[model samples]
Target chain A: MTEQPTEGEPIRTGIVGLGKMGISHFAIVNAHPDLELVAVADTNSFLTSAIKRYTKVEVYKDFKRMINEAKLDAVLIATPTRFHFEVARYALERGINVFVEKPFTLTLEEGRALVDLAKQKGVVNQVGFHNHFVGTFAEVRRLVNAQAIGEVYHVTGEAYGQVVTKPKTSTWRSKKSEGGGCLHDYASHVVDLMNWVVGPPVKVLGAHLNSIFSEGVDDAVHAVFEYKNGMSGQLTTNWSDTTYRKMTTRISINGKKGKIIADRQEVRVFLMPGCEVDGYGEGWSIKYITDLQKPVWFYMRGEEYSTQIDTFAHNIKSRNTEGENTFASAYATDEVLDMIQKADRARS
Target chain B: MDRILFGDNQFFGVNHMSEEKARAQSMKFKDTAAIMKVIDVAYSEGIKTFMCTTHDRIGEVTDIVRDNPDRYNNFTFYPGMPYAHKYANAVGELGIMGTLKKFAPGSIISTVIRGAMAGITQDAYELMKMLVDAEMQRFQGTRTPVVFLQNVVTDLLLGFNMREMFRAFHDYVQQKYEAEAGFFSMNMPMLVDVLHGEGIENPIVCSNINKIGFRMCGGIEKYIDTLKTKQFRPIAMSVYASGAIPPEEAIKWVCELPKLEAIVFGASSRRNIVGTRDLVEKYWRFDN
Candidate 1:
């Protein structure tokens, strides 16, 4: 692993891409007691100029120059999915810890290369599968591990949002070449959570990618997955649903003796007469996120965002590479994405 | 600050406990009249201080309140600024510069010049003032005694260690709007410390303060200590912990906290509104 920073000195950090996510990360990173945000790079001049004018941190139009000049101990890459591989690769080659936003890379090959390079450099590497940090989802993982829902036989992962009810113009998110689609922009979260709670699927049984609003990309994705042990699951995601005010992800696990349904806000579990789990009733038990979540030092839209960043910071400090949502784990999710795509193609 | 303020989260489909309930609430309050109906109920119950975000829909509510001054007599609004979704949507529709030009609080040319000047002088405080003015536009022709910075921006600024922005907001609101600046944060203990460090004594701050400590960043003990000792006006939100705690216990617990200046809760029905008002009146004595 890279040499740990001095005992008292904050970890030098830089962030690339000042989009919505990037700006949020900037605030969190800057506020972190153990992180010193030295510089930021974004192509948007207005954002860069605003940062330069408002704060003392440096700004740059080129991320490469920022990495070279800032001498960052870690870098957070929130660029479009197409740029994740390039930005993360550059940082990893220089022995800098990297935290890339979700949908790790555009292709499985690119994700594999980064995973290997991160291992070679012995640097901390993580992907932004933020659901892994959500308390309810994390609780779901714990319950599944403890067999609270005994021997999960099936699962259903679903996500819905009002991202594009009516297609007006195309942004990077609506363009397929830029890795904007239901699969990458939305469903990957549910898929990653599924992979985490239930083991990764060994095969894709069927898949359908539909373009309801966008011409170049799928607005909704549906697929079935089959595990090697004969367990099966499905993914249902849509970004064009007007019913949702924001993106909501839910996972339901069906076991032989019980069932568990969970979202960001709460987890619901139902057990048969003999199926017993600690702190849960035999008939039904409900746990709200407030009960499950630990307080974060800072909270923005949600606690998961800040918690993920804090976990990354702790991993870097402790020189631990095998934390949650590592590049390796994210690559496994990427491989699942590839399987679904190939399944859809074969069906067509 | 009013001792019992009614929030607008329920009308805006922001149920922290369940997505299904939030969706149902969204569908139920799809019309402006539907939202006003609940506000009228809360108003009738003497909870006249409506702590609301400056959502576009709230602008409509403001218009109704402005028109019917006799009905809403003594009505006060505690407006929270930088309704983040509005800005996010604006950025999506109009690019960043376009959004700046659209919401820059004045004529396009003058705003452009002022923006450039702010950039050159390195005075983001001026831009912040302008944006505050822009958000406060809808609350015009009404009484806004306390204007709050939303927790999203408040906590973000707190994270950035930007103490001056807090001071700037406090000073700007006091001077221009003739109002006390309120801050909403998830981390109450940290924010109270930061505001005190900025020399803002007896500051008005709102956060989640409930029996279970749901969303209380520094935990219940630290919050209790802050409430017991800090020299600031504390307004408790999420008192029910998003429906996890029963109303009786929740109201009783928070009402007993030391130095609690106000409690804000949101409900959609007249029965729930009256019920909550009764609970507060039963436990906490409010002096006129």
Candidate 2:
């Protein structure tokens, strides 16, 4: 795009693992004048052979060989979970910037260790929690802090979609050995969101149920967290449901100024004039604290995602310039995700 | 002193007192209930908030608050739904693509390595670090005030490092809101007591995470004991789970309620309403 990778020019980039996400990354990389998809790697021989025939740049069976031979300035890891550590570590150890996918690690220790390694090697390393870049949550967070809804006393969230039915026979997901469960794959995002909205989960209580497509791994999960500020939240995620395929990500915060519900992408505020409920029967009357008029939909999508990416890039660049490419920012909220999975596993 | 929140009166159990006692110490003694009993008490006492569950005992608070518009005005309930159980995310991801990439028959399986780099450490940690970083970013300068709920899982199913587990949650939250004084789980009230007594000194937010069903259980005195060891900003909760008690008794216990900083409890019946009023009035002892 920019004629060629030039000295002091924006770094040319390539992506590995051309699944849907990988392919998207590829096109995006190529679009950047300063960046180019110099090479692409996929283990599938047939896929690699086909890609080689279609693309101008070289294609390889392995990312490591591609990185070494192609001399890439940066690599976008679109690879699966287990392979991340190896690929990321290799790239960092070599001085190549790396962008790896989410979950970072299946275990906290592993995740922590990678962070440490990133620090030691001083390479540009980042894990994608892409949603954080979106601006809506930040606005909702702003209102909550301003006591916009009053005092966020309690919070609840529901994330629903197709439920995961563990296949009868056997898949990696069926066994609880890998990161195949719904909690890790899906709820981790919710958990991360919880950390972002409130704080860290002081405690996490979970119920992992695997019914429909059951080999072993759970399909749906429900979790509750108690915040340190005396606030609390609940998050529910499902990967298997035959019904309407909808993803409802709503956070209802009962605050003081009003009742706030952050539904899907935007935040809504309701004025709660704590009044009396009408009479139900006899002398006893119920409270009429329902249907507080409020903001319905106010979405801010692009900014948050961009901010998230920029922050990672900035951290990486700062680290690189300083010869300490380790993430200089605060600890990521993901440390507890695997624990949620582990805890969910023991919910019986 | 940590912030204290009064749970619904019945949480301490109403069945313990009598109907006669209920009549004697009811709100008719002068229902000073203003701005919702809980919010009034919280505002008056300078307390923040408290947690509540929609359990059987929860009925008591709903009953009283249901009727009175004045006394139980801004009563906020901290619903304890989907209580903390435990969980884990084991087996890291296999490589992303190529023959080395392990694909599950369904979701995620095996640690597929092509030839040499098998079982290598992954970027999972980096993901967590970034997440923690981002969380802190959210609460860096929050005005509404936030705290961390320090948690411990007795039945941990994740990789061992219990301390690391605690640290992860702590650091994660610390990145955002100012870390609260302390954390509480139903089972670990004693642990909280120890952590507090040991001088960890952050105010403790009450949670029955450790206690399981705080209603059907005992050992609440773990809280009382902790209270004794060191004065806690007891966000007192779990009073309703005391069982199908009468309003009078619930009110009376609430009247006593360890008197930390704040208490937010609901009255179950007319008697409970009256008792709540009487409890506030009598305890503050004729205070204007």
- Measured by TM-score, the strongest candidate is 1
lDDT values for all models: 0.88, 0.47
State the displacement of the C-alpha of residue B72, model 2, in Å, after optimal TM-score superposition: 64
Model 1 stretches with alpha carbons more than 4 Å out: B89-126, B197-199, B285-288
The residue-by-residue lDDT of candidate 2 on A55-125, one tens digit each, is 56578888888878887767788675666677776776666777776656665566676677766765567
Native interface contacts kept by each candidate, as a fraction: 0.48, 0.00
Quality class of the docking in candidate 2, CAPRI style: incorrect
Score every model by TM-score.
0.94, 0.46
TM-score of 2: 0.46
Q: What DockQ do the predictions score, one after another?
A: 0.49, 0.01
Q: Alpha-carbon error at A141 in model 1, in Å?
A: 1.2
Steric clash count of candidate 2: 107
Task: Name the Cα RMSD for model 2.
Answer: 24.9
Error of 2 at B196 (Å): 72
lDDT of 1 by residue, A70-98 (tens): 98999999998999999999989888999
